[model samples]
Target chain A: MTLNPNRAAGATPLVAMKDISISFGGIRAVDHVSIDLHAGEVVGLLGHNGAGKSTLIKCLSGAYRMDSGEILIDGEKAEIHNPRDARRYNIETIYQTLALADNLDAASNLFLGRELVTPLGFVDDSRMEAETRRIMGRLNPNFRKFKVPVAALSGGQRQSVAIARAVYFNARILIMDEPTAALGPQETRMVGELIQELKRQGLGIFLISHDIHDVMDLCDRISVMKNGVLVGSEQVGDVTEDEILGMIILGKKPERAGVN
Target chain B: MSDTAEAHGAARKRSFIETLEIDTRLLGMIGAFIVLCLVFHFQTDGRFLTPRNIFTLAIQTVSVAIMATGMVFVIVTRHIDLSVGSLLALCSAVMGMMQVVVMPQMMGMGFGHPLIAPLAILSGVVVGVLIGAFNGWLIGYLTIPSFIVTLGGLLIWRNVAWYLTSGQTIGPLDPTFQLFGGINGTIGPFWSWVVGGLGTAAALWSLWSARRAKQVHGFRVKPAWAELVMGGLVAAAILGFVAIVNAYEVPAARLRRLFEARGETMPEGYTTGYGLPVSVLVLIAVAIAMTVIAKRTRFGRYIFATGGNPDAAELSGINTRLLTVKIFALLGGLCALSAVVASARLTNHANDIGTLDELRVIAAAVIGGTALSGGMGTIYGAILGAIIMQSLQSGMAMVGVDAPFQNIVVGSVLVLAVLIDIIYRKRTGGFK
Candidate 1:
């Protein structure tokens, strides 16, 4: 998905990319893609299943390094060679499976690798519990607390925990891969509310999803891509579903008509 | 009642009531302990519980129990340290050589304060750790399976241990070292009772703390009320065990009479009682420490994560390789510690220092509820399992049970533990 610079806002772009490219083996999965995520903005990357959306996001998340082009974080050129480096850049990613320890509960999942430890040098359960309660209160107040293991949590609650984990670590850019892919209507709405909360916190969210309606409802700007190329980015209010579809299929912006 | 309704009601009650039942592993160990006691008590016509007889049991069981504690950690990580027995033998041989060759040389050099015994022990630990680290590095970083690494380690270490002493017995250790393993009686057996009580209390406290933390953090905590009641019962059981062991004594007041009959002087606390073996105290301490680490530490959590899903752990930013190495090194150090204790008790070090010890140690860990596949276990359970096995060996010997029969019985117990574990996994939807 390409970023459009015409729509200026008060929030600064946390991540600015210029002509990033990544190829696996001999296949160019992502090519010459430019994306900018402003603070407190939800940018939905719209594409077909193989439209290079995931490949591009993976490069940003540091799962794969770009073959060419530069990435700037807050206008500073950043080198992200690994996931750990991406985390240091405040780029937290939530994959489709949630990538959580099923045997561990919400608190443990929230602080999986980086746990709150006590003075005695053990995993500090009390403090972790208090912190989990506070964060869940803000992001998902209705989430049940008794189920400690992630295995027992519902789809929405598990996503909430994964999101909460990234947020708790002070994530500035959240890359969500189909956060509501397997959820029911009510659960999807719950996630929608969560995305809104993150947006209010000035977090730049790059949501990659197949649901166009979800993109229209939540994203500030929608970028369509097809065949490893950026089609165009348009303000959600200005673009119709047909126009977005056309951009995805043809890799070019459709002509604007006189209709409202 | 209608047949279908009756069956449904019965199933509901069974499901509800089953939660209160003792876990199968615990049940198995306790059952084994009781049956052994009964067999020995009946066969010996109640003479097996005599103070002298009980002390014999203490010494007999210490070596296996110590090894089992270390085995618990390795097994929990879904790895096997087949080198423990080899490490044990090697360490003891080093200690023996220090006592026989090095100390005498030091004494000849006019060094009044001979440091060979202590130095030998330290060397043993270092050697064990280094070998363990080597094995750990191979298995952890190189992504080798634990069984293969430890199997290779077993051969290498056992040969080293054998070569260290020229495959011969080396003995006549310092009196101080001997006292640790020997001197089964002291201060009227009160010290043993105190140690037991303190040990049991510490176990209870740590168990409570772990469960409390799990509850607070919203971890999958066991039922609190059940845990508390179980803790109290275990504490009380220790107290009761102390009372029973004390009762088994010939009476301290009577010990003086035997001495008087022979017109000989006696040491303090010489009066007869089961009194604690230093080995037993060491065993209990190891158990408590292991439980704390496995349940409450970040390292322990990593161990579980590594076992449950290595890929997921790696993705979570855990150094799975490093964790595996640390666990193996811990196994080696623990085995060395056990070797030191065992040598102190035997008052000798030899080629057969830890003969067939692997079977007993691994058996204890397995029987204690540690999964051979890893990801679930308790140190306390491992200790209980070791104690049960040791008791069986001692009790059977006391009852004049044939050696072949004892071996068969122990083998059956091991097989039964594995079977019980299988059933548990099935019942619990394959606890991983």
Candidate 2:
């Protein structure tokens, strides 16, 4: 596998979290860690369980507050006190749970927080459905169950709703936690195609996953974390699967790799 | 290729079955209501379908139906209010006292004044809202489970009613106040027909606009014939109701016969028509308003969303706790309105008024298709559920069914409705 040669050549980092730290109870869940994502790039976050990768991403998604850290978006300091704050910065997170209201139809769930309303303060459901259809045409052309509750949908289609929600809201930075974790091979490939399409549209994505093959196939760069600490980050072409595995289990960088 | 063709045919049949199953529960409820009416119509020797009996049944349904509409909201938000009956009683007691005792004394009027009835009803509603707000505050802000809070309220509020009236019935309410709940307080036949015509127009307009909007958005819509069929059904239902009431005229001959039976001479030119009862009109207005709130408003969407998934709703920037409070408060206001209707109908207020009514209200909502576990319900369904419940009671009584047997039947129906709902959910892939 080879990385795109121009992956990180001249793009400015769109989001940077410096020395982020957080603790649960008396234990440090995430030790001092720093990571940056450039515009139009897909950065894969790989880690074993309890490695604090999710917790670290949670801080950026505004699901958790870091004990000590500063986050910069587009080189400006950003204070994200909650999920709404993260949304204001055009950052949307698709949690592993998908965070969808199961009883609502696709258009309703897509506009759950920010509904389209007529001048009379009535929910403009027709307009919302039309918009959902337009966006789904681009993201998942096969989607057709617009009126059924999302709970009746397949996992892949539900993921499409979640993705469409984030993307339709003009999100520039996306944090997708295990986007392909519960999908079949076909669905995983579908998500992979979606990620590639999103990348082409110049959105920076932080994809947290344990699937190394997925990381290699879709990510421009891979960052591995172990025990709440950064083991290493390398351009995908700069290392092989064995070296990435060694870094994950042994908590050491490959000797031949150039530091990213 | 033959196998593929067979599979396609089977798939189409299966999809058709699925759509039928999806709609059958509501259709079943409607069918059950019609069957019940038919059986009772035969059992009563045609008296059950008489306009007078039907009008009386509608009036009896108003109080329960009004509360059932509110119960849909309460239950949709994943909460239960067992205190509604007691709340109604207490509000009735307060309103009765204000009209019969407090207002007269304060104004120094020897007889009840015209303004006293309206003032008393307003106070009753205010008291209802206050109690509802308190319940909401505890359940929403204090994070107490609604079941425990409202259960505690059931005991406390009923006792408060008993204490307020000192176990005595307050009686002989103001004549004008009694009109709000009386049979003669109905809109006349002419006005009833006018109202029915207007309602038919509104229904057709709404259907046309919805179809037009869907088409404008380039979405799939029902055929024009389907819309026309629906509009025709609504018009028939409304106009039929008006026709029934208009047919209930008290002929001068029947009046003379009654006067002779009572050993009195008949008066000249005595006549009457039942028209539409004022209480039924109140119920209809409440149903329409609640339907709008449940279908169109942001608050209504929030209620469903909160009931569907509290965590997701919270993360989506919904102030779920505040929404919970608002829903409970709305329930309270409805309880007050119900109290007014109940007290007016009786021309009196008693300690036992509205006792066991909470059960009936809850039963009506559940029967109508509001999920007890929440997140799915409709106002029209609740009203129909109320109708079914009252029909069962009235029909059984007319057929000389014992009181205990009536309870047994109603309880079994409630359980059956919920069981059907569960089966429906399972068929639909289990509660989303």
Candidate 3:
């Protein structure tokens, strides 16, 4: 993939994944997919199951290594072979399953791989709990169960933990896979507001969702994929909800929204 | 929830148990252990609780107890090590050869050399680490199941030990090495109280500092009274154990023999206590070190995290495969250490050394409150579990129970322990 003309004209997108191709055995899970996001923008990746959206996003998140692809952050090629590498580039993920170690407390889950260590190299647990308490107090003031395992937490509380983990580490580019899929309507609205807040703080987000309505309401642009290929990318203002749905289902771009 | 407001309310409202923050499951395990001890004491007509009997039990428990600590880590990571006993035998055989045969006879170094003990220990531990790494590689990189890998290891290593020693006992090890076995070696009464005193001080210091640290961070701390009570109880336990072990007097005949060896005439009416066995000290060091690694280190956190949800751990940037290798390797090192104590205690390494120790070690860990399902276990619990297992066997033997019947009873106790643990955890809403 060539460099975007927009990069030469002005600012680089916060993240640019170009020509990502990955395969399992002989089957191609993601085929030559390219996607990008810019600062302060919410890019919704919409597709049905087996449309390779998750696979494509996993490559960017460093959960899966793309067979042939380059990921650029702020116009520089970033080599992320594992989640640790992705983290170093300020890329964080909230997986569809929330991906918290259920046996560990919320503070342990939050710090996780990068724990707050003491001067003598032991895990600084109390400090971590205090930090978790401080952050949760800001993010979800009602959060009081800091000592219990995340398995005992409610759906919204768990979601907030996943989000807080990303936010605490100062994520510049966030990959959220079905962040509200398991939450109630009220919790869903709360997540919608959280996404807005992240966007307001100029953090680029890639929201992978099956809901066309969520894309229409919260996304700045929509990238639809089908059968391991991208149909097209369109601005939310240009494409109606029906057009986006057609693109997801039929894997074809509606002509009206193709111009701009 | 400002500083004084929260602390004052919690201090006034919380019960003693709540303030201590002790695990209910751990308390239950300890309660069971104590009950078992009491039953054994009664059944054996009080012989089981005698100072001499308890001291002997401590030495007998050391080898398996040390191995059980490692088993806790293995089980916590959702793995089982059926090879530990065989590994111990192999380690013992290797060390025996190093000190008695290989270095002294073949390498032309005299036996009982100071270097012989250290060199033997190093060789044994290295061999264990290599084998453990091999097992871990099969499990982690090759994706072989741990149970199958270790089961195969159980057979392969036992025969390998036989091959190493030609199915003969390797013995008359270096004298320095024998000290590790608690065979005619002990710290005596004076140093025992010193260790107990230092341990008491450290325990109290940790409790105080932890409370202060919490307060400094504006986090909730236990009440002043609760902290004092906790400290007092810990200190008392430490000193009490030291006192019991120290009460076992050294025999007059053995004291006379010791004086003759040192080229001195025995004094009339002289008596002394065998304060602490070296083997027991080794086990204690292992317990403390293992506890620290489990509670305060990154490796330990990754272990629980991976055991909890492997996908989550991997996504969190932990190299779980490597972690597996490291864990098995650590257990292997512990196995070698246990071998040192076992063979040394025997005054020689026999072909049948550590035979069936696998079942005993696993039982100890399980009884000690280690969850077979993973993401849970405690070093202290496993040590106490080892004590309970040993006490059962010793108490039965004291009562003149048949050896076969003793096995039947111990086997039944293992199953009952697991069952009770499951029901307790389920009722308490603990992590299953």
TM-score of chain B of each: 0.82, 0.90, 0.95
Better of 2 and 3 by lDDT: 3
Model 1 scores what on Cα lDDT? Answer: 0.75
RMSD of 1: 5.9
- State the lDDT of candidate 1 residue by residue for B58-152, as single tens digits: 66676777778778768877788777888788877776777677766754532224566567678778877887888899998898888888777
Task: Give one digit per residue, the lDDT tens place, for model 3 in B69-159.
Answer: 8889889889899999999999999999899899999999887677999999999999989898889889989999999999999999989
Task: Identify the runs in model 2 with alpha carbons over 4 angstroms from their true place.
Answer: A1-12, A66-68, A256-260, B1-22, B107-114, B182-184, B250-270, B428-432
lDDT (0-100) at residue B278 of candidate 3?
A: 90
Question: TM-score for model 3?
Answer: 0.96
What is the C-alpha lDDT profile of model 1 across A106-217, one tens digit per residue? 7766776787898889887567777988899888887664334566567888888888888899999999988899788998998898898888888889999999899989
Best prediction by DockQ: 3
Residue B113's C-alpha lDDT in candidate 1?
A: 40
Positional deviation of B145 in candidate 1, in angstroms? 2.3
Chain A TM-scores in order: 0.91, 0.96, 0.95
1 or 3, greater by lDDT: 3
Q: Candidate 1: which stretches are off by over 4 Å?
A: A1-12, A17-34, A45-70, A79-82, A145-148, A222-260, B1-58, B106-114, B182-188, B197-232, B244-264, B267-270, B392-412, B429-432
Give the Cα-based TM-score of candidate 1 against the true structure. 0.82
